[model samples]
Every structure is written in C-alpha cells, then in structure tokens.
Target chain A: MEKLQEINNKAALNASGALSKLIDRPVKMNITMADVRKVEELSPVIGPEEIVAGVYLPVTGEITGAALLIFPKESSFNLSDLLVRREPGTTRKLTGLDKSALKELGNIVCGSYLTVFSNALQVKIIGHVPSFSFDMFGAIVSQIITEFVQKSEKALVVEIEIIFELKALKGYFLLLFELPQFNAILRSLDSV
Target chain B: MMENIEVNMGDLVVTKNQDKLTTSAVGSCLVITLYDLKFKIGALAHTMLTDRRVSHLKRDALDATSSSARTREGGNERRHEIRDMKYVDAAIDEMIKKMVTQGANKENLEAKLVGGANMFPALKSDIGKENVLAAKKKLKEEGIRLVGESVGGSQGRSVEFSVASGIVTVKIKF
Candidate 1:
C-alpha cells in the first residue's frame, strides 16, 4: 500500500511539472472536482449544466488513436471564425472553408494534452490528421468508447474545458490514453 | 448537325453523328458506354455503385418506369429506348440498342469502360471494385464485347468517347 501510494504521488507531481513546462507556465494538475468545474465554466457555451461528451484516441498507443473533439454547433462555428479570422455572420458552415481551421485546432488541443502526458510519462507520441463531425454528443462518445476504449483494460481520460473569449465559445477536451501506455507511465513513476 | 453531349453524374446522354461525350474526375464510379459506328449513336452511363441495393429504395419510383418499360420492347428498338433511361443496367442495354438502331450489328458493337477509383481511404467498402465487377457482369450478360477498359485503382480518370470512331480516351491521375 505504501509503495503504490508513493508511486501515485510521484506520478501526480511528474504530470504537474510536465504540464507546467509544456504550457510555459505552472499548471494546476489533477482531475479534481474543482478542475472539473473550471473546465465547465471556462467557456460560457459548455457550462456545468451541459452533458459530458467523449473524445477518443482509438489507436492511442499505435500512432495515436482517432481523436474526436466535439463542440456544440454554435461553439464550433464561433471557434472556426476566431481561428480563421472571419467576420461575424460569415454564413459559413463548419463543413465548408472552416474544415481546415477545425483540423488545425484539433491538432493544437490534442497536441497540448499529449505534450503533458509525454513529459510526465517520458513517452514519445505522434498524432495524425484530425477529423471532426457535429452530432449528438452522446452518440459520438458512445461510438468512440465502444470502438476504441472498451477493448482496453483501462484508460486515462483527462477532461478539460477550453474557453476563448473572442468567440464566446466553450468546449471540452477529452484525452483518452490507452491502458498499456498508462500502465507504463505508472511503472515509470514507481521507479522515479 | 452533330453536337457533343456531356454526361454528368447520375445521368445518361446519347448522341449520333460522331459527336464526343465526356465525363470528368470519375472516382469510385463506373463509366460504361456502347457505341454503334454505323448508326453514329452512342450512350454512356456513369454509375457510383455496383448494385442498386442502397439506391433501390430511393430510386424505386424511377426504376418502375425504367426496367419494365425496356422489357416490353423487342430487340433494337427496345434496347435503344431503354438506353435512353438512366441507371447502370438500363443505360448499358439502351446503348447497345441505340448502336444497333444506328445500323451497327449487335455482334459487331464494341463496349468501353473507364473509372472506378477508391477515393476515400478510410472507407473499407470497396465501391470502386464493386462497380468494375458489376460493369463486367452487365456487359457479358448483354453479349456486348468489351474491347477496352480502364478500371480499378486509387487514381481518378476522365473519359472522352468519339461516337464516330468508337474510340474512348481515358486520362488517369494518381
């Protein structure tokens, strides 16, 4: 019990340090109840009342599983406008010229989360081109979890809410780490 | 008086008098054409799927008038008229008929096929392969000889046919 507790504490410290380094600032690390609230409130669009959506990285250990970043239709459009510098009321759908911007945003958000994981765990990870779809959040989450998550013994999921004031857009980032990869990180923390 | 007719997706167009018919950037789709050199008539069908299973529900109304109407007519006239209808099977059959109507013998008519590219890599369903197989089966059943074909690859193709010469030129891009 003592050894496992030491490992867990060390892992948490390592994760915190890594996130701070990656963001170039100290990050308050933990999937605590408070952090959950922060994730929700950061964006006015994704408040505490909204349902928790799932974003998956299916091939997590193998070249990074497919990562799905879900945003509300309105939030997605707002983010697209901010990312592309489009004027308000651009009348463009997310599927139109905004596809490229969405892709880039996914890359950045997913990359940031993975950077934290890699630094804390000392693992090298790479991601592929991101694909986005606007659908009922539950349906999308269920699909990803069934296709990618259920196959694993366990998964490390980090849920964060991102806010951009320019667009008044709020959305969640669900990072799913594969079981084996998470275990390896745990082991590294034990030795550390 | 010969004028070229351009065929787009989900469409069939026929022309006589040596006019050229063309379609561009065909991906995961089949382009089948029957030309009658003597009659100077030709028809082309660009189909995205091998079977009508999915389209069956959506195309039921259109199919009712198309399939049964062709069966009621006799050889050349029936074939030519049916080819005037849309969809894969009828379009090929009609092309052969139109060729015969234009004075080309059924046995002497030549069929040319092109396109069938796997455009979506993530999709495991091989629509392109299915289209190629369906085109081959349809042509064989109709007793139309396929003199030339360019099918089945990851690249897109653009095809142009000369009804006057019964020649099909296919340009492929990787």
Candidate 2:
C-alpha cells in the first residue's frame, strides 16, 4: 500500500506538471489521500448536494476501469476561466467552449497519470474520449459508481488539493479497476 | 420534534411515526417511497440498480457484504448478513413487505418515486431509465397508486419523504 501511494504521489506530480504546462501557469497539487476504498465510500468527499463539474474517461486495455476528475462549482468556473484565457472569476456558467476546455484538461491530466503508471508497471493503458458532466456532486459520482458496480465493488480513490495563483481548490481524481486487474497492478508494483 | 432518518444507498427504512426519511446525491439510483395514509405508516428505499437477477456482480457483492458485515464495537462483536438492497425490483418489494409488516394497509398504500437521473448524457447509459421503469413496473404489479414523482433528467436530486403527510420533496442544485 505504501508503494502504491508513493507511485500515486509521483503520478499526481506528473499530472500537475502537465496541467501547469497546458495553462501556462505555475500550478501546485498535493495528494491528500491515495488509497483503495469501497465504492460506497467514494461519494462523500464533497457534499452530495454541492454542484460540481466532472470529467470521466473510460480506461481500457490491461485494466478495465475508469478515471474521474472532479471540481467544485467555483473551482470549475475558476479553472475554466484560466483554461480559456478569460479573466479570473468571470465564468459564471459553462459554455460549449469552456466545457471543451475542461474536457481537454481532463484528458491531459488523466493521460499524464496513465503514462506514469504504464511506464512504471510496463502495462498498456488506454484512455478513451473524455465525457463531461456538471451536476450535483453525489449524482455525478453515483453514476460512475453504478457503472463500476456492474463489474467491481472497489476503487482506488486519490484526493487532491490543487492551488493556482494562491487560490486553493479541492479536487478529486479517482481510478477504478476490476479486482483482478487491481491485483495485477499491485503485483506489478511488487516486482518493481 | 419530528425525527429524521437517513437512508443510504441500497438500504431501506420503514416507520409508522412522523419521522422523515432523507437521502441525497441520487443519480441514476431510484428512491421509492410507500405510504398508507390511514395507517400512518411509510417506507423509503434507496435502490441502486435495475434488477439483481441481471446483474453480474450479485454473487460477488453478496459475498463481500456477508464477510464485511461483522463489526466489533466496544469489544463486542456482532455479525449480520446485509441484503443487497440496491436493486430496484428487490428494494421495492422489500419496502412494501416492510410497510405491511409495520401495520401499513396494503390496499391503502400509495407510492412516490424520486431520483433516476442520467448525470452523464454522453455516456449513453440507460441504467437510470431502466431503474425508473423497473420501479414503476413493480409498483404496478403491487397495485400501489403512483401519486408523484420527479425523475428522468440530467440533474441530481436530494429527496425527503415525510411519512406523516405522505409528502415527497425533491431538491436539485440549479
């Protein structure tokens, strides 16, 4: 578990570096938690009723699972402003352009994390096209959990704290893998 | 003071008093409530999937819950097998049975439904729609009158079902 956490920390760092490069700004991210959890325990990180923007990327290949990136309402708008080059705090509602920008941002962040894992474990991982949704935090997360419940009962949850320009943002990046695939991942790490 | 009971995912709560049953962050999952006005008894279920029969993880989930059902608190160990109440069909049936057991008249029971939202439109998943349909079908089979519902959208909803008034309030973040 410690080794897995360490790998996730490195992956988080890689994701932050990629995000900084994309937005052309210095971005800092801290991995608040990196551990395995039951699917039921994954939705309470943010208030269920709180509005949030989520980017979901279905992962295939050696691991059949999904990756989810979440941002609270204010942080989503704030990040959208930065991603689309609008004045900070100006994005009240997400437009098509802003949504696309968010999806692109999700792709980059998830891709970076997958890249690090693939390199570390010598596993081929593919992230499909990203899907975006903005809704209640519980609702968004429930859909993903339901999707995975058809296959697995557990997930690897990674909570992250993102800071940009002195404004701290609470975000979550979750990875879900089937039990066998998850064990394979751990075994690969053991060999490493 | 009216008591408030929280219903978690794949769980059901039945009461004969004025307690309010609440559940939040409902996306794709279905919340079914049954009430008998004359008896003043009601039950609420937070169901996750359409049907357990069609689910591939039914065996695994049940086995997992069975083992994890043991808990030690204050040096006392307790063991209880938890039924996977997340299936719409099973959950609604269980709720009706519980309501009847709690003195709710089967003939006088009315029903309300909430949740069942496709939070991600791009995913093209029909679990939400399927769950809603399954619940409706179950209610019909059970002869429960469908009184009110707030369902089938891209919005997440939080629900509060008052057993006293048979009033179901659904809230969503605009």
Candidate 3:
C-alpha cells in the first residue's frame, strides 16, 4: 500500500507537469491520500448537486480504471476561454469548439497521467479519448462509481486540486483505479 | 423532526411523513421515486445500469446483477440473496415492498423518475436512453403510473421528493 501511494504521488506530479505544458503556465496541484468520505464531507468538494463540467477518460490495461477532470461550471468557461485565447469571461456558453478543446486537453493530460503508471508497471496501456459533459457533479461521479470501475466497498481515488495562483482559478482531478487490481498495481509499482 | 434522508448511488431508502428523500447528481444514472400519498411515505432509488444481461460491461458492481453473473453455471445451490437496490428491477421491487411494509397501499402509490443524462457523448450507445427505457418498461411491468420525469439530456439533476405533498422537485445543473 505504501508503494502504491508513492506511485500515486508520482503520477500526480507527472500530471502536473503535463498540465503545465498544456496550459503553458505554472499550476500548483496538490495530491491527497485517497478515501471515500461520508456524504457530509463529500458534498462540498463536489457541491450539493452543483452543476459541473467533467472530462472522463478510460484507462485500460492490466491495471485498469479511469480518471476525470471536474470543474465548477464557471471555472469551465474560464478554462475554455484561457485555452482558446479568448478574453476571460468571454465564453458564456460552451460552444462546439470549446467542447472539442476540452476533450483534447483532457485526453492529453490523462494520456500523460496514465503514462507514468504504464512506465512504472512496465505495461502497455492506452487512454481513450475523453468524453466531456456538463452535468451535476454527484450524478457524474456516481456514474463512474457504479459503471466504470470494479466494485469495492469504496473508491481507490486520488484528489488533485489545481490552482492557478495568478488567475485565481480552482479545478479538480480525480483518478479511480480498478479496485480488484490493487495488488496487481502494487506489484507492478514494486517491479521497479 | 423532518429529516432529509439521503439515498446513495445505486441504493434506496424509505422515509415517512415530513421526511423527504433526496439524491444528487443523477447523470446517465436514474433516480426513481415512489410515493404513498395516504401514508406520506417516499422511496427513491439511484440506479446506474439498465440490466445485467449485457456482456461488455466491466463494472464490479453489487446487487443481484453481479451475483447472478457470478453464479451463472454453478450447481443448484441458489437461494434468495439479500436484496440490493443497485439495479433498476430489484430496486423498484424492493422499494414497493418497503412501502407496503410501512403502510403504503400498492393501489395508491404514484411514481416519478429523474436523472438519466447522456454524459458520454463519444460513446456510441446511449446508456442514459437505455436506462430510461428500462425504467419505463419496468414501471409498466409493475403497473406504476408514471407521473413525471426529467431525463435524456447532457446534464445532471438533484431531486427532492416529499411524500407529505407527493411533490418531487428537480433541479437541473448544467
């Protein structure tokens, strides 16, 4: 477990590097130890039914699971504007170009995020193109919980907070790995 | 005290009187609500997949769905397992039974459906649409009158169902 935690931290750091390259700016992202909290604690980070924009990517290989980038609805607009070089607050509604931009960005970050695991475990893994959505945070997270990963009593997840110091932007990244493959992932991490 | 009982993803609970039943962020997932007007009791289920028969799915999910898959070809040692509300069929059945145990009349129960958004656009099959169809078919099978629904968009929804008023309020967040 300790080894896997170390790997998780490294993957998170790799994600930060990838994201910085994507945005061409410095972003401070913190990775925390993962656990599913009680609903009281869960509601605020995700919001009590707050609307959000999420980009979901499937990670498939020996150690399979998924990852997602979630943003508060307003944050999505701002992020899209920043990515496309539009004036801040210029994107009131997400256009086709915006959605495409978000998907491409998610794919790149997730691809890089999973690359760390693939390298550590010596496995060949691929990240699917992310599917983007604007929805309620709980609904989206629940879907991933129920449909995407193997059922464990709780989720093996890593929470990432991405902060743009100058822009005052806040966003989140959540990675959920296959519950049944915990030992498989750990063993792979140990191989190095 | 009128408490707000939360129904988790792929789970359900029954509440009575001033108490309300609530679930959040139902996207591509379905929230089915049952109300017994006379008893002021409410039940809600947050369901993800439509059925268990599909082979391509790779979730290590709970409920009878996965268990049945696990026991498909085993020798006849099957007895009724504990009920789980993760699947749509079992959830509705259990919700109805729970409502009955709490003084609800099957004849007087009304139903409302919420959630079921197509969160995954790149995927060809629409799980949200499939969930809606499955729920509608099951409701028809159970003879439950479908009062209302907010489904099949690219958004998430939060629902609060009050049995006291038989009113289910839905807030869509996009």
For model 3, residues B66-88, the per-residue Cα lDDT tens digits are 55444333677554543556667
Can you write out model 3's per-residue Cα lDDT over A1-192, one digit (the tens) per residue? 555566667776776677678788776555665554332355666775777778988777665666777778888888788778788779999888888887776676566657765776677777776898776777677767655553342344456556664665555666666555655654555565
The best candidate by TM-score is 2
**Interface Cα RMSD, each model:** 15.5, 2.5, 2.4
TM-score of each: 0.44, 0.87, 0.81
Which residue pairs of candidate 1 clash? Answer: A58-A65, A59-A65, A60-A65, B28-B117, B39-B102, B83-B94
Ranking by lDDT: 2, 3, 1
- TM-score: model 1, chain A: 0.57
| Shift in Å, residue A126, candidate 2 | 1.6
Number of the candidate with higher TM-score, 1 or 2: 2
Docking class of 3: medium
- Candidate 2 on A48-151: residue-level lDDT in tens? 78888899998888767889898888989998888899988899999999999999988887787777777777788899989999988878877876776442
* TM-score (second chain) of model 3: 0.84
Kindly report which residue stretches of model 2 are placed more than 4 angstroms away from their true locations once superposed. Answer: A1-6, A9-17, A24-33, A39-44, A150-152, A161-163, B52-63, B66-83
Misplaced by over 4 Å in model 3 are A1-44, A89-92, A150-165, B53-82
The positional error of residue A67 in candidate 3, measured at the CA in angstroms, is: 1.9
Distance from true location, Cα of A109 in model 3, Å: 1.3
